[model samples]
Target: MQVLNKVTVAVKGMVQTIKYPVVWKPSLYMFLSLALSISTHEGQFYWYTNKEPPNPGFSQEFVGMVHAVGAVASMVGVLIYHKNLKDYPFRSILFFAQLLHGASGLLDLTFVLRWNLALGVPDAVFVTLEECVSRVVGRVRLMPMMVLSTKLCPPGAEGTFFALLMCIDSLGMLVAKTGGAFVLRALHVTRTDFSNLWLAVLLRNLLRLSALGAIFLVPTADQTDVLLPQDLLSSGSPAAAAGDEEERLLQLGKLTSHTDDDV
Candidate 1:
């Protein structure tokens, strides 16, 4: 009961913290964008796994190669963002991320349309390139939100707050994947049927572009300016420390009472 009450207070405190527009706006924007970014991928995966008569098949080794290259590409994306794009305004970077992500979404369309084959590109080569580009763009899109997460952390609870932000990211990813699966199902994309995959690709790109509407949620000004109030910068919530102190005192009182009983 005591622990439950404490948890309720902590949750309420967190609710109070997020009530600030500066806090909630950007968080919501990140969550929605992350969630929506993945909604169009199921069709592509269906086409890949279910490539039948007319469609080309990707070899298992090549698929593994694509995954490996994608991991490296993600690292490169983060490095490039931190090195070159970190100083740019958050809105500008995100605007370009949306545009670039939309453009990358085109590669999916090209693959689905077999335009690469028409253009004399081998399926193996083209798909790997597409995977690398997609991973890089996705990682780049996520970087600014990560940087913002740190800036939003209150003075004292930085680690816990950042972990909470990561949990939000995970939740967004879950929603994105689930939403993507639903889109695939709605389009009747199956292991053996991917006739409508191009539509899914188009929908994904549209969704990526749609996030532009929420760009206003992110703060345009620097956190040092007005994003965080002076009081917030000065101190953080000491709830954990206070709880520890109270628990210590209670334990000490109990120990003293036990000693008296022993006497």
Candidate 2:
């Protein structure tokens, strides 16, 4: 998880340097891919336990197949979206996807609580779908946050900014996982208990939803420049066209330049 967080930070910082609208689209797709990867692992595990055979191999196989299929589907999605990238707002798509993802997680919790084998299959399916959707939304959530962090750093300190983001994100993940385990243990709950597991799942989804909501409060690419209209106006038409563009460029440049000067 730590390593993955680091990679995410790196990717976000790198991708923000690319063209807008275009960069935003790919980030969504990538986020969906990430979501799929995460959701599938849990789904596969659920499937294995629910099945009569309870074979770990079957779970592994299921994950592998889904991953392979996802790879192909993602490639196709990228190609299809390439032409219409700018038509969609990345944040809008991301919010919808996250809502769906949270809904799926909630459904999973419901099925677990009820111990409905009949419902379990559908729950697993929802999880699978959420996984796919997450791939797109995850990137949406991650990239914007990274871009914001990069914007706040001193000039030429992009590496430091990225490192801090990674560290914080990884720490959050570790705390979440560990805290979850502790909660379960403290409650004397077992994974097989439908009610206990469901509660845990519900809490997890709630946390995720809250996090998503928090992202909405941050200034968008456009709103970031509200603090400095004069600086933005000085940059001319291209920079003035998108406030976010000017703010991001100036912030990043200042950070990078400052770092160079410091060195």
lDDT by residue (1-263, candidate 1, tens digit) is: 66875666566556656677787888888888888776665456556655475576766566777899999999999998878888777778887887898889999899889999889998888988999998989888888888888877666556766777788888998998888888888888877788888888888888888888999998886423436566566555443444455578778989999999999
Estimate the TM-score of every prediction.
0.87, 0.50
Could you give candidate 2's per-residue lDDT for residues 1-263 as a string of tens digits? 54564455445544443234333333334333233322223432554455443222236566666556556655554544444332345455455545655665654464444444444454446445544554444444444344444443323334654465455555555665566666556544543433355455666677556545433433344313322233223542222233345457668988999999999
RMSD of each: 3.0, 11.5
Q: What lDDT does each candidate get?
A: 0.78, 0.46
- State candidate 1's TM-score: 0.87
lDDT of 2: 0.46
